[model samples]
Target: MISGDVDAELRRLADDPSFPHRDAARHAIRFRAEGDVSDLVAIEDDPHPCAMTDVVFAMAGSKRTWLNWVPMPAEAICNVANEVGSRRAEGEDLGLVSLALSAAEPASAITASERVMGRVELGIGDFPAPDIRMPLRRGRYAIWRYDGTDPVPAVPAPSGAAIRVLHEVGGEPWSSPLSGYVQAEPLGALPLADLLGLLAHLPGPPDTPRWEYLAKSTPTYWYRLLQPWVCLGILRHAADEPWATSTRREVLLDLALGIEDWTADAALFALVTAAYRESELRAEVHQVVRARLNAAASAPRLVTIEESLAHLMLITPGCTADDRALATAVLARAAEAGEEDEDEQAPPPSKAEKRRWWQRRG
Candidate 1:
């Protein structure tokens, strides 16, 4: 939409080798004039390039420097604590003592970091789940015994002392290339319109081998956005947004089937896990699985795709007969290609694994 002398001046700035902000100028010009010249941009120059970056930049304000994100809902605190407890019980060197403090009926805590904030609550009749842990942060935590009902940040209190310095909880750092988003702002601060804008403008499937190879090196911010806990939390918070109604499901289905990387599995995982509570999403997942299975007949099945199929069989609820048949045929194709079936290799768990089912990127 940019035209007139302004467009000419911007283009000149972008093309001027001596202009210190030439790259920014180029991005501005590219942003205003649509149609992807992304193909022409060097990977080094656009390491985490995606429409989401544009959305995040505009929404977060141009004056910021770092992105502060809360990766999970408050409920995930209990999950993380329970897993740490489990690991300690098994004599593993998780290096943390277990705490069992009784709070009057409902226990509440406030989870806050840099820009994001949420509250964790354990209701009177309900206790935390056994082995469904989701990690939130990665650092040393101070655990204190407080009797009052005032909300606090913490892990479960151990039996020994009233206050203790708890070493960092065993969790992976949620670092992404988009960690530095040109400024400091809480992810919770982003508006639903901006979030949906990013979702709607996501790049479609790669059509070129160069893009495919590049995908292996530079991932979109969706890698962080679509993490299981983050995606689930967003769905909960934006229950009224198009995410709850239709936009999320549609975008996820497209990414699950179109994208060909861990991000795709993340998309697929979000679809299946969200389906656990939403019947409409469950139906959508079934349709996606059916279509994906049909396409597997000829498409080159990568490990990511195989693992996605395994997740479908393992976690997807109300699996239909037709869907199962398609999956079986797809696994057969994978076998012919000499790829190991992930499901066959998985050991039955004594308790549900409290981590992402799919392999993590090293």
Candidate 2:
């Protein structure tokens, strides 16, 4: 049997008016100890989106810290779409995990997303598997989603095939010197500017399935190819150049502002790189990046800003002293904000004491 204190806490949470799906939370807690998630499927029948989300999180034993949760039911999947739509409408940053999980549910999730987000701009990893039948609407575009994961398959590409595809896509051929460098050092060690140069010719949006296939099959080349365009947009803005006039620049900016659109590592890299290149932009970059980090930290589930900063340091060891200091300050502020939020959400000490009594009895 579950501990009486846990049961009472679950009941209290279920009854909490702030969360719409009270009964779902209660019942979900009741059955959470069960090994199989199938029993929780009935919660999907509930019309309240929050209730379904609660049940899904409960079944998966996932704390609702971040906006995203896993083991989401197919029926509850639409809730994620609805949330994404609403957040995008309000001009808020959606969490990275939320977008990835939503993409995993391609059908209704995609439909709801397109209806709300309009002409969805997807990353390479964001593409639904080739088998997925996307709607016939015209506005969706495919760009690279750089998560820092080496998507390159173990098998080497057929001779000349990679170069042929690069030429076909209008991208510059990989340089022999850079190729030798990549072979010698870690792929992450490649210069950001060179990566941007390679991405210059790659066309944006309206990409074909063939292009997607080629990119996915040869992820390292695809990453090197696509990053230039994404990185250049940030660099342009950092240099105080006029970027608002360009539609491509607008898309790239939108992707940056919409935190869920790109991987956390990719987003951080762009911001940090921009800051590193243009000392003048460090303050602005710090503010923007801090806001997103704080937003993630403030979510119901705790996403440590420190972890993100640590990952950034590991991937981009060349970050300047100023960059490191700014990141450190941003993380400290985010941590403080998270603590304040937790204090606000926590029940009174008297209530906690009573709950402790129940725990002692159990």
Candidate 3:
């Protein structure tokens, strides 16, 4: 339950005219710090909208944390029209995994999540797979009620299905189901070698039915949403070791250049982070940096590309002069984009432009 003081503080922040993203993020962190159902309901009810990164960071910041939101039977059919619209306006998609990973007490939360998932029947046909992820971290898992609304067009619900209408603060309505969450079994942490072995089984051959299904189910791209988390885990495990020892240099390189922007960003983060601790990885980091700079030359203002470039420059010292030159050109173009952004009326707090979520983990 939300403490009297916490409820009042959230209310005060919501009423303040100058609530910023940082404030919203700090408040969002309360989800992990205090795992009370009423507290989450209060945070959800708060008028100040939160950015997707704020929520992600809160959920993934620690291994022991988890969050499972089980709506009251009376609240199960909630019209999340505003919630849906706000997320779309901010270019975000929420899943059960994202919300449930914020619980402070993972053991109870996991049990609670499993019980809730068992009661909610899975939707049939192309009802869009719920954002299901297993073992977000050691002992932690998440299970939220509503999946994203972006797949509404591509994955229509069967007729007569009980669909929930979602909306942003002021955005149009979109239909989404109130029950798509599924139970995910928790796994123990594996050694680097074992983790690599498990990862090798993913994104299997192109002709398979599973691959075809994934292509149709995922939003916009076929990239695995878990790619970043997995990459980050690998980086954390091998930061102090030589790249050759892990036998996964090629894996990181492939992920760094993957089609999914977030996955690529995570791969680059892993590469650069490792390069800082292991001099042996510097050469590969430089090669990736150069490739990214060249690819970003024409469209320098792209947020993800610029973010990768900035992270490399910040962490990897003594960058090659050629890379520096290319980076300079990209920043020059990005500056022009910033000017345009300044002139446009500011977007909503949740929609405001900012760095990628992984970079802000620090």
Compared with the true structure, all predictions reach lDDT values of 0.35, 0.36, 0.34
TM-score of 3: 0.35
* Model 3 lDDT, residue 358, Cα: 12
CA deviation > 4 Å runs, candidate 2 = 1-229, 232-252, 263-265, 302-306, 313-362
Clashing pairs in 2: 65-300, 65-301, 66-301, 196-228
What lDDT, from 0 to 1, does candidate 3 have? 0.34
Q: Report the Cα lDDT for residue 67, model 1.
A: 15
Candidate 2 to truth, TM? 0.28
Q: Which ten residues in a row have the lowest lDDT in candidate 3?
A: 176-185
Candidate number with the higher TM-score (2 or 3) = 3
Ranking by lDDT: 2, 1, 3
Per-residue lDDT for 1-362 in model 3, tens only? Answer: 12244444544554667755434545445644653222333333345644533233223222221121111111101112223323443556633222211111111122222222222222211221111211212111111122331111111221211111100000111110000110100111225443333232222223434434433322112122233334545554533555575534655665555332333554565565455434566777867755654554543222333534543443343365555566656556556755765777755412113211111011
Q: Against the true structure, whose TM-score is highest?
A: 3
**Every candidate's CA RMSD:** 22.7, 23.4, 19.7
What TM-score, to 2 decimals, does candidate 1 have?
A: 0.31
How are the candidates ranked when ordered by TM-score, highest leading? 3, 1, 2
